[model samples]
Target: MGTVRRRLAGRALSGSLALLGVLLVVPSLYSPTREMAVADREHGSLLSHQWEWSWGRVRVAGLEGVELRDQWNPFGLAVLVVLLVSGLAGVCVWLARRVTWGHVLGLVTVGLLTGRVLTTVAERLGRSLGEVDQGAAGLTVRTEMTQAGSLETVAACVLVVALVLMGVAAARSTGRSTLPAKLPGTPAAGTAAAGPPAGRAGPAGLRPVGEHLTTAPVSFDDAGAGGGGGGADTPATAGKPGRTP
Candidate 1:
Protein backbone atom coordinates (compact mmCIF):
# COMPACT_ATOMS: atom_id res chain seq x y z
CA MET A 1 0.00 0.00 0.00
CA GLY A 2 2.80 2.43 0.91
CA THR A 3 4.69 1.67 -2.34
CA VAL A 4 1.58 2.19 -4.47
CA ARG A 5 0.86 5.51 -2.72
CA ARG A 6 4.40 6.70 -3.33
CA ARG A 7 4.26 5.81 -7.04
CA LEU A 8 0.97 7.71 -7.47
CA ALA A 9 2.34 10.72 -5.60
CA GLY A 10 5.40 10.85 -7.83
CA ARG A 11 3.30 10.67 -10.96
CA ALA A 12 1.05 13.49 -9.72
CA LEU A 13 4.04 15.70 -8.96
CA SER A 14 5.47 15.13 -12.46
CA GLY A 15 2.12 15.90 -14.05
CA SER A 16 1.85 19.14 -12.09
CA LEU A 17 5.32 20.17 -13.19
CA ALA A 18 4.44 19.49 -16.81
CA LEU A 19 1.30 21.60 -16.46
CA LEU A 20 3.27 24.49 -15.04
CA GLY A 21 5.65 24.22 -17.94
CA VAL A 22 2.79 24.51 -20.39
CA LEU A 23 1.39 27.50 -18.51
CA LEU A 24 4.72 29.15 -19.10
CA VAL A 25 5.02 28.16 -22.75
CA VAL A 26 1.63 28.83 -24.41
CA PRO A 27 1.45 32.65 -24.32
CA SER A 28 4.71 32.83 -26.25
CA LEU A 29 3.07 30.93 -29.10
CA TYR A 30 0.02 33.18 -29.51
CA SER A 31 -0.43 35.22 -32.67
CA PRO A 32 -0.02 39.01 -32.83
CA THR A 33 -3.74 39.42 -33.60
CA ARG A 34 -4.60 37.85 -30.27
CA GLU A 35 -2.16 40.11 -28.48
CA MET A 36 -3.44 43.22 -30.21
CA ALA A 37 -7.02 42.29 -29.45
CA VAL A 38 -6.17 41.85 -25.80
CA ALA A 39 -4.42 45.23 -25.87
CA ASP A 40 -7.43 46.90 -27.47
CA ARG A 41 -9.68 45.71 -24.67
CA GLU A 42 -7.31 46.87 -21.96
CA HIS A 43 -6.17 50.21 -23.38
CA GLY A 44 -8.84 51.27 -25.84
CA SER A 45 -12.63 51.77 -26.18
CA LEU A 46 -13.09 48.79 -28.48
CA LEU A 47 -14.88 47.01 -25.70
CA SER A 48 -17.33 49.89 -25.36
CA HIS A 49 -19.10 49.28 -28.66
CA GLN A 50 -21.65 46.52 -29.31
CA TRP A 51 -24.82 46.70 -31.43
CA GLU A 52 -27.54 44.46 -32.87
CA TRP A 53 -30.26 45.20 -35.41
CA SER A 54 -33.54 43.39 -36.04
CA TRP A 55 -35.22 44.04 -39.37
CA GLY A 56 -38.08 42.25 -41.18
CA ARG A 57 -38.57 41.83 -44.92
CA VAL A 58 -41.55 40.44 -46.83
CA ARG A 59 -39.39 37.59 -48.11
CA VAL A 60 -37.40 36.99 -44.87
CA ALA A 61 -39.13 35.65 -41.77
CA GLY A 62 -36.42 36.84 -39.36
CA LEU A 63 -33.31 38.88 -40.03
CA GLU A 64 -30.81 39.83 -37.34
CA GLY A 65 -27.66 41.92 -37.65
CA VAL A 66 -24.79 42.13 -35.18
CA GLU A 67 -22.05 44.75 -35.12
CA LEU A 68 -18.87 44.72 -33.06
CA ARG A 69 -17.50 47.82 -34.76
CA ASP A 70 -15.36 48.77 -31.76
CA GLN A 71 -15.67 45.51 -29.83
CA TRP A 72 -12.16 44.32 -28.97
CA ASN A 73 -12.99 42.11 -25.98
CA PRO A 74 -13.77 39.22 -28.32
CA PHE A 75 -10.06 38.74 -29.03
CA GLY A 76 -9.12 38.64 -25.37
CA LEU A 77 -12.03 36.37 -24.60
CA ALA A 78 -11.06 34.07 -27.46
CA VAL A 79 -7.49 33.85 -26.21
CA LEU A 80 -8.63 33.17 -22.68
CA VAL A 81 -11.03 30.49 -23.88
CA VAL A 82 -8.35 28.82 -25.98
CA LEU A 83 -5.92 28.79 -23.08
CA LEU A 84 -8.53 27.35 -20.76
CA VAL A 85 -9.55 24.63 -23.24
CA SER A 86 -5.93 23.73 -23.90
CA GLY A 87 -5.30 23.35 -20.18
CA LEU A 88 -8.42 21.27 -19.82
CA ALA A 89 -7.35 19.07 -22.69
CA GLY A 90 -3.98 18.54 -21.07
CA VAL A 91 -5.58 17.54 -17.79
CA CYS A 92 -7.96 15.19 -19.57
CA VAL A 93 -5.10 13.56 -21.40
CA TRP A 94 -3.19 13.16 -18.17
CA LEU A 95 -6.11 11.60 -16.31
CA ALA A 96 -7.01 9.26 -19.17
CA ARG A 97 -5.63 5.74 -19.50
CA ARG A 98 -3.43 5.05 -22.51
CA VAL A 99 -5.89 2.48 -23.82
CA THR A 100 -8.57 5.22 -24.02
CA TRP A 101 -6.44 7.57 -26.10
CA GLY A 102 -9.02 7.72 -28.86
CA HIS A 103 -11.78 8.64 -26.45
CA VAL A 104 -9.71 11.34 -24.83
CA LEU A 105 -8.72 12.76 -28.18
CA GLY A 106 -12.34 12.84 -29.24
CA LEU A 107 -13.28 14.57 -26.00
CA VAL A 108 -10.71 17.29 -26.58
CA THR A 109 -11.92 17.82 -30.10
CA VAL A 110 -15.46 18.18 -28.85
CA GLY A 111 -14.28 20.63 -26.25
CA LEU A 112 -12.67 22.77 -28.94
CA LEU A 113 -15.89 22.87 -30.89
CA THR A 114 -17.86 23.70 -27.77
CA GLY A 115 -15.47 26.49 -26.93
CA ARG A 116 -15.97 27.98 -30.36
CA VAL A 117 -19.70 27.87 -29.87
CA LEU A 118 -19.30 29.60 -26.52
CA THR A 119 -17.27 32.30 -28.22
CA THR A 120 -20.07 32.86 -30.67
CA VAL A 121 -22.57 33.07 -27.81
CA ALA A 122 -20.49 35.63 -25.99
CA GLU A 123 -20.21 37.77 -29.13
CA ARG A 124 -23.93 37.53 -29.76
CA LEU A 125 -24.69 38.54 -26.21
CA GLY A 126 -22.32 41.46 -26.41
CA ARG A 127 -23.98 42.64 -29.60
CA SER A 128 -27.45 42.24 -28.13
CA LEU A 129 -26.55 44.39 -25.14
CA GLY A 130 -25.89 47.44 -27.38
CA GLU A 131 -22.19 47.41 -26.55
CA VAL A 132 -21.28 48.38 -30.12
CA ASP A 133 -22.35 50.78 -32.91
CA GLN A 134 -23.06 49.78 -36.51
CA GLY A 135 -23.05 51.88 -39.74
CA ALA A 136 -21.64 51.98 -43.26
CA ALA A 137 -18.72 54.34 -43.86
CA GLY A 138 -19.52 55.00 -47.53
CA LEU A 139 -20.75 51.93 -49.37
CA THR A 140 -24.07 50.17 -48.56
CA VAL A 141 -23.77 47.65 -45.74
CA ARG A 142 -25.63 44.36 -45.70
CA THR A 143 -28.14 44.59 -42.87
CA GLU A 144 -29.11 40.95 -43.19
CA MET A 145 -27.37 38.53 -40.76
CA THR A 146 -27.57 35.44 -42.95
CA GLN A 147 -24.21 35.95 -44.57
CA ALA A 148 -22.57 32.70 -45.69
CA GLY A 149 -19.01 33.71 -44.70
CA SER A 150 -19.90 34.05 -41.01
CA LEU A 151 -17.84 32.08 -38.45
CA GLU A 152 -21.01 30.88 -36.66
CA THR A 153 -22.04 28.62 -39.55
CA VAL A 154 -18.68 26.88 -39.61
CA ALA A 155 -18.68 26.46 -35.83
CA ALA A 156 -22.24 25.11 -35.85
CA CYS A 157 -21.43 22.27 -38.21
CA VAL A 158 -18.20 21.43 -36.42
CA LEU A 159 -19.94 21.40 -33.07
CA VAL A 160 -22.71 19.09 -34.34
CA VAL A 161 -20.25 16.49 -35.64
CA ALA A 162 -18.02 16.74 -32.59
CA LEU A 163 -20.96 16.40 -30.21
CA VAL A 164 -22.28 13.33 -31.99
CA LEU A 165 -18.90 11.62 -31.93
CA MET A 166 -18.37 12.56 -28.32
CA GLY A 167 -21.74 11.15 -27.36
CA VAL A 168 -21.05 7.86 -29.12
CA ALA A 169 -17.61 7.44 -27.61
CA ALA A 170 -18.71 8.40 -24.11
CA ALA A 171 -21.63 6.00 -24.26
CA ARG A 172 -19.38 3.13 -25.22
CA SER A 173 -16.86 3.94 -22.54
CA THR A 174 -19.34 4.34 -19.68
CA GLY A 175 -22.38 2.25 -20.64
CA ARG A 176 -20.56 -1.00 -21.40
CA SER A 177 -18.01 -3.25 -19.75
CA THR A 178 -15.28 -5.57 -21.03
CA LEU A 179 -12.98 -7.90 -19.12
CA PRO A 180 -9.25 -7.61 -18.97
CA ALA A 181 -7.14 -9.92 -21.11
CA LYS A 182 -5.52 -11.99 -18.38
CA LEU A 183 -8.26 -13.46 -16.19
CA PRO A 184 -10.29 -16.19 -18.00
CA GLY A 185 -12.76 -17.06 -15.25
CA THR A 186 -16.41 -16.13 -14.90
CA PRO A 187 -15.78 -14.52 -11.51
CA ALA A 188 -13.52 -11.95 -13.20
CA ALA A 189 -16.39 -10.55 -15.26
CA GLY A 190 -17.39 -7.93 -12.73
CA THR A 191 -17.81 -7.05 -9.08
CA ALA A 192 -21.04 -9.04 -8.52
CA ALA A 193 -19.55 -12.43 -7.67
CA ALA A 194 -19.87 -14.84 -4.73
CA GLY A 195 -17.39 -14.63 -1.91
CA PRO A 196 -13.85 -15.88 -2.57
CA PRO A 197 -12.94 -19.57 -2.32
CA ALA A 198 -14.37 -21.01 0.93
CA GLY A 199 -11.00 -21.72 2.55
CA ARG A 200 -9.42 -18.45 1.43
CA ALA A 201 -10.23 -14.89 2.44
CA GLY A 202 -9.78 -11.62 0.64
CA PRO A 203 -8.10 -8.51 2.06
CA ALA A 204 -11.13 -7.92 4.29
CA GLY A 205 -11.92 -11.35 5.71
CA LEU A 206 -10.57 -14.50 7.40
CA ARG A 207 -7.57 -16.40 6.07
CA PRO A 208 -7.75 -20.04 4.94
CA VAL A 209 -7.67 -22.92 7.47
CA GLY A 210 -4.97 -25.28 6.26
CA GLU A 211 -1.67 -27.05 7.14
CA HIS A 212 0.21 -23.89 6.15
CA LEU A 213 -1.38 -22.08 9.14
CA THR A 214 0.75 -21.63 12.27
CA THR A 215 -1.23 -22.24 15.49
CA ALA A 216 1.53 -23.54 17.77
CA PRO A 217 2.87 -21.61 20.78
CA VAL A 218 6.59 -21.39 21.65
CA SER A 219 8.20 -20.43 24.97
CA PHE A 220 11.17 -18.05 25.09
CA ASP A 221 13.40 -20.78 26.53
CA ASP A 222 12.40 -23.30 23.91
CA ALA A 223 13.13 -20.77 21.11
CA GLY A 224 16.30 -19.14 22.54
CA ALA A 225 17.87 -22.25 24.11
CA GLY A 226 17.07 -24.25 20.93
CA GLY A 227 15.86 -27.21 23.06
CA GLY A 228 12.59 -27.76 21.14
CA GLY A 229 12.35 -30.28 18.27
CA GLY A 230 11.92 -27.27 15.96
CA GLY A 231 15.63 -26.36 16.33
CA ALA A 232 19.01 -28.17 16.14
CA ASP A 233 19.28 -31.44 18.17
CA THR A 234 22.00 -32.65 20.49
CA PRO A 235 25.34 -33.88 19.02
CA ALA A 236 24.35 -37.59 19.48
CA THR A 237 21.18 -37.15 17.44
CA ALA A 238 22.41 -34.32 15.18
CA GLY A 239 23.93 -36.62 12.50
CA LYS A 240 26.67 -39.24 11.72
CA PRO A 241 28.78 -37.44 9.11
CA GLY A 242 26.15 -36.63 6.38
CA ARG A 243 23.69 -39.45 7.34
CA THR A 244 20.26 -38.45 8.73
CA PRO A 245 19.96 -38.77 12.53
Candidate 2:
Protein backbone atom coordinates (compact mmCIF):
# COMPACT_ATOMS: atom_id res chain seq x y z
CA MET A 1 0.00 0.00 0.00
CA GLY A 2 2.75 2.41 0.91
CA THR A 3 4.70 1.65 -2.23
CA VAL A 4 1.69 2.27 -4.40
CA ARG A 5 1.09 5.64 -2.76
CA ARG A 6 4.66 6.71 -3.20
CA ARG A 7 4.70 5.75 -6.85
CA LEU A 8 1.53 7.68 -7.47
CA ALA A 9 2.90 10.73 -5.68
CA GLY A 10 6.09 10.70 -7.71
CA ARG A 11 4.18 10.39 -10.96
CA ALA A 12 1.87 13.21 -10.00
CA LEU A 13 4.72 15.52 -9.19
CA SER A 14 6.50 14.73 -12.45
CA GLY A 15 3.36 15.32 -14.46
CA SER A 16 2.75 18.62 -12.69
CA LEU A 17 6.23 19.82 -13.56
CA ALA A 18 5.69 18.99 -17.21
CA LEU A 19 2.36 20.74 -17.22
CA LEU A 20 3.91 23.81 -15.64
CA GLY A 21 6.51 24.02 -18.35
CA VAL A 22 3.77 23.77 -20.97
CA LEU A 23 1.81 26.51 -19.21
CA LEU A 24 4.84 28.75 -19.33
CA VAL A 25 5.17 28.05 -23.02
CA VAL A 26 1.52 28.93 -23.70
CA PRO A 27 1.85 32.61 -22.83
CA SER A 28 5.04 32.99 -24.81
CA LEU A 29 3.29 31.53 -27.81
CA TYR A 30 0.39 33.95 -27.65
CA SER A 31 2.52 37.10 -27.14
CA PRO A 32 -0.01 39.50 -25.71
CA THR A 33 0.10 43.29 -26.08
CA ARG A 34 -0.91 45.71 -23.31
CA GLU A 35 -0.80 49.44 -22.57
CA MET A 36 2.06 50.47 -20.33
CA ALA A 37 1.19 54.08 -19.50
CA VAL A 38 -0.31 57.26 -20.89
CA ALA A 39 1.99 60.16 -21.61
CA ASP A 40 1.38 63.90 -22.42
CA ARG A 41 1.24 64.74 -26.13
CA GLU A 42 1.60 68.02 -28.09
CA HIS A 43 -2.21 68.57 -27.97
CA GLY A 44 -4.53 68.77 -24.91
CA SER A 45 -5.12 65.01 -25.07
CA LEU A 46 -3.03 62.19 -23.62
CA LEU A 47 -1.12 59.61 -25.67
CA SER A 48 -1.10 55.91 -24.77
CA HIS A 49 1.96 53.77 -25.37
CA GLN A 50 1.68 50.04 -25.94
CA TRP A 51 4.09 47.30 -24.92
CA GLU A 52 4.11 44.28 -27.26
CA TRP A 53 5.68 41.09 -25.86
CA SER A 54 5.55 37.83 -27.74
CA TRP A 55 7.57 34.92 -29.00
CA GLY A 56 10.57 36.17 -31.04
CA ARG A 57 9.87 39.90 -30.70
CA VAL A 58 9.13 42.90 -28.43
CA ARG A 59 8.12 46.42 -29.44
CA VAL A 60 7.11 49.79 -28.01
CA ALA A 61 4.37 51.74 -29.76
CA GLY A 62 3.49 55.44 -29.63
CA LEU A 63 0.74 57.57 -31.22
CA GLU A 64 1.95 57.14 -34.80
CA GLY A 65 3.11 53.44 -34.87
CA VAL A 66 5.98 51.33 -33.58
CA GLU A 67 8.60 53.71 -32.20
CA LEU A 68 11.13 51.24 -30.75
CA ARG A 69 11.50 47.50 -31.21
CA ASP A 70 13.91 44.85 -30.01
CA GLN A 71 14.16 41.50 -31.74
CA TRP A 72 16.35 39.86 -29.08
CA ASN A 73 13.80 37.27 -27.93
CA PRO A 74 15.89 34.58 -26.32
CA PHE A 75 13.09 33.76 -23.84
CA GLY A 76 10.78 32.47 -26.57
CA LEU A 77 13.22 29.90 -27.90
CA ALA A 78 14.13 28.85 -24.38
CA VAL A 79 10.51 28.32 -23.33
CA LEU A 80 9.76 26.32 -26.45
CA VAL A 81 12.64 24.01 -25.66
CA VAL A 82 11.39 23.60 -22.10
CA LEU A 83 7.97 22.70 -23.43
CA LEU A 84 9.34 19.87 -25.50
CA VAL A 85 11.49 18.65 -22.66
CA SER A 86 8.57 18.61 -20.27
CA GLY A 87 6.55 16.52 -22.69
CA LEU A 88 9.31 13.99 -23.19
CA ALA A 89 9.96 13.76 -19.48
CA GLY A 90 6.28 13.22 -18.74
CA VAL A 91 6.15 10.34 -21.15
CA CYS A 92 9.24 8.78 -19.65
CA VAL A 93 7.88 9.19 -16.15
CA TRP A 94 4.66 7.35 -16.98
CA LEU A 95 6.21 4.57 -19.02
CA ALA A 96 8.97 3.87 -16.55
CA ARG A 97 6.63 3.36 -13.63
CA ARG A 98 8.23 1.55 -10.68
CA VAL A 99 11.57 1.56 -12.47
CA THR A 100 14.43 3.44 -10.82
CA TRP A 101 16.24 4.03 -14.07
CA GLY A 102 13.10 5.44 -15.67
CA HIS A 103 12.54 7.91 -12.86
CA VAL A 104 16.14 8.99 -13.10
CA LEU A 105 15.88 9.38 -16.86
CA GLY A 106 12.77 11.52 -16.59
CA LEU A 107 14.40 13.71 -13.99
CA VAL A 108 17.47 14.14 -16.14
CA THR A 109 15.40 15.17 -19.11
CA VAL A 110 13.52 17.74 -17.08
CA GLY A 111 16.76 18.99 -15.58
CA LEU A 112 18.36 19.59 -18.95
CA LEU A 113 15.36 21.41 -20.32
CA THR A 114 14.25 23.65 -17.44
CA GLY A 115 17.75 24.46 -16.24
CA ARG A 116 18.30 27.07 -18.95
CA VAL A 117 14.76 28.42 -19.03
CA LEU A 118 15.10 30.32 -15.77
CA THR A 119 18.40 31.85 -16.77
CA THR A 120 17.08 32.81 -20.18
CA VAL A 121 14.10 34.65 -18.71
CA ALA A 122 16.18 36.35 -16.07
CA GLU A 123 18.81 37.48 -18.56
CA ARG A 124 16.52 38.52 -21.39
CA LEU A 125 13.10 39.55 -20.15
CA GLY A 126 13.19 39.93 -16.36
CA ARG A 127 15.44 42.94 -15.82
CA SER A 128 13.69 45.36 -13.45
CA LEU A 129 13.29 44.59 -9.75
CA GLY A 130 9.80 46.01 -10.06
CA GLU A 131 8.06 48.57 -12.23
CA VAL A 132 10.26 51.45 -13.36
CA ASP A 133 9.20 54.72 -14.99
CA GLN A 134 11.55 57.16 -16.71
CA GLY A 135 11.11 60.25 -18.87
CA ALA A 136 13.39 61.15 -21.76
CA ALA A 137 12.89 63.55 -24.70
CA GLY A 138 9.27 64.39 -23.72
CA LEU A 139 8.37 60.66 -23.69
CA THR A 140 7.50 58.60 -20.61
CA VAL A 141 8.56 54.96 -20.58
CA ARG A 142 7.48 52.28 -18.12
CA THR A 143 9.59 49.19 -17.73
CA GLU A 144 8.44 46.05 -15.93
CA MET A 145 8.43 42.29 -16.33
CA THR A 146 5.51 40.87 -18.20
CA GLN A 147 3.09 38.56 -16.34
CA ALA A 148 3.83 35.66 -18.66
CA GLY A 149 7.57 36.05 -18.35
CA SER A 150 7.39 36.10 -14.58
CA LEU A 151 5.26 32.97 -14.61
CA GLU A 152 7.71 31.20 -16.88
CA THR A 153 10.61 31.98 -14.61
CA VAL A 154 8.68 30.81 -11.56
CA ALA A 155 7.53 27.62 -13.29
CA ALA A 156 11.09 26.75 -14.31
CA CYS A 157 12.24 27.02 -10.72
CA VAL A 158 9.38 24.85 -9.50
CA LEU A 159 10.05 22.19 -12.11
CA VAL A 160 13.67 21.88 -11.03
CA VAL A 161 12.72 21.53 -7.37
CA ALA A 162 10.00 18.98 -8.09
CA LEU A 163 12.33 16.73 -10.04
CA VAL A 164 14.95 16.77 -7.26
CA LEU A 165 12.37 15.96 -4.60
CA MET A 166 10.86 13.19 -6.68
CA GLY A 167 14.23 11.52 -6.89
CA VAL A 168 14.55 11.65 -3.12
CA ALA A 169 11.11 10.19 -2.49
CA ALA A 170 11.73 7.34 -4.86
CA ALA A 171 14.96 6.47 -3.14
CA ARG A 172 13.40 6.37 0.30
CA SER A 173 10.56 4.09 -0.76
CA THR A 174 12.67 1.58 -2.66
CA GLY A 175 13.90 -1.84 -1.38
CA ARG A 176 11.26 -2.38 1.24
CA SER A 177 11.29 -6.16 0.92
CA THR A 178 14.92 -6.60 -0.10
CA LEU A 179 17.38 -7.72 2.53
CA PRO A 180 20.72 -6.10 3.32
CA ALA A 181 23.55 -7.08 1.01
CA LYS A 182 26.25 -9.36 2.40
CA LEU A 183 29.64 -10.50 1.17
CA PRO A 184 30.22 -13.89 -0.48
CA GLY A 185 30.48 -17.04 1.70
CA THR A 186 28.74 -15.36 4.63
CA PRO A 187 27.00 -17.77 7.03
CA ALA A 188 23.33 -17.49 7.90
CA ALA A 189 22.07 -16.10 11.20
CA GLY A 190 22.10 -18.52 14.23
CA THR A 191 24.78 -19.61 16.72
CA ALA A 192 24.54 -23.36 15.99
CA ALA A 193 24.58 -23.10 12.25
CA ALA A 194 27.33 -20.47 12.24
CA GLY A 195 29.66 -22.43 14.59
CA PRO A 196 32.16 -25.06 13.37
CA PRO A 197 31.47 -28.86 13.64
CA ALA A 198 32.11 -30.41 17.07
CA GLY A 199 35.76 -30.74 18.14
CA ARG A 200 37.98 -31.19 15.11
CA ALA A 201 39.51 -27.75 14.66
CA GLY A 202 37.28 -24.96 16.01
CA PRO A 203 36.97 -21.38 14.75
CA ALA A 204 39.74 -18.75 15.27
CA GLY A 205 42.41 -21.48 15.56
CA LEU A 206 41.10 -23.10 18.81
CA ARG A 207 42.41 -26.57 19.75
CA PRO A 208 40.28 -29.76 19.36
CA VAL A 209 38.20 -31.22 22.28
CA GLY A 210 40.54 -33.83 24.05
CA GLU A 211 43.91 -33.30 22.41
CA HIS A 212 46.05 -33.89 25.63
CA LEU A 213 44.71 -37.40 26.47
CA THR A 214 46.83 -40.45 25.47
CA THR A 215 44.55 -43.18 26.93
CA ALA A 216 40.97 -43.88 27.96
CA PRO A 217 39.79 -42.98 31.53
CA VAL A 218 39.65 -46.47 33.10
CA SER A 219 39.36 -47.46 36.81
CA PHE A 220 41.97 -49.68 38.65
CA ASP A 221 39.40 -52.43 39.46
CA ASP A 222 38.29 -52.67 35.81
CA ALA A 223 41.92 -52.84 34.73
CA GLY A 224 42.61 -55.72 37.24
CA ALA A 225 39.60 -57.74 35.92
CA GLY A 226 40.71 -57.29 32.31
CA GLY A 227 44.19 -58.48 33.25
CA GLY A 228 42.65 -61.98 34.17
CA GLY A 229 43.46 -61.70 37.94
CA GLY A 230 43.83 -59.22 40.83
CA GLY A 231 47.50 -60.04 41.18
CA ALA A 232 49.79 -57.97 43.44
CA ASP A 233 52.51 -57.87 40.76
CA THR A 234 50.21 -56.41 38.14
CA PRO A 235 50.83 -52.91 36.68
CA ALA A 236 47.56 -51.66 38.29
CA THR A 237 48.71 -53.12 41.69
CA ALA A 238 51.81 -50.99 41.49
CA GLY A 239 49.44 -48.08 41.90
CA LYS A 240 49.08 -44.99 39.72
CA PRO A 241 52.21 -43.49 38.19
CA GLY A 242 51.62 -40.03 39.76
CA ARG A 243 51.02 -41.37 43.37
CA THR A 244 53.52 -40.83 46.29
CA PRO A 245 55.51 -43.90 47.34
State which candidate has the highest TM-score.
2
Model 2 worst lDDT run, 10 consecutive residues = 41-50
Error of 1 at 30 (Å): 12
Candidate topping lDDT: 2
lDDT of 1 by residue, 1-245 (tens): 77546544543443444344334323322311111111132333332222221110012121232232332345545665565466556545644535556455545644554565455445544543542323232222222223221334344444555455445545554544463655665455455466566545657664555646444553344454556674553332222355322
TM-score of 1: 0.30
Measured by TM-score, how close is model 2 to the native structure? 0.52
Clashing pairs in 1: 49-131, 49-132, 50-131, 50-132, 51-132
Q: lDDT of each model, Cα atoms only? A: 0.41, 0.59
- Lowest summed lDDT over 10 consecutive residues: which window, candidate 1? 53-62
What TM-scores do the predictions have?
A: 0.30, 0.52
Residue 178, candidate 2: C-alpha displacement in angstroms: 8.7
Query: How many pairs of residues in model 2 come into backbone collision?
Result: 0
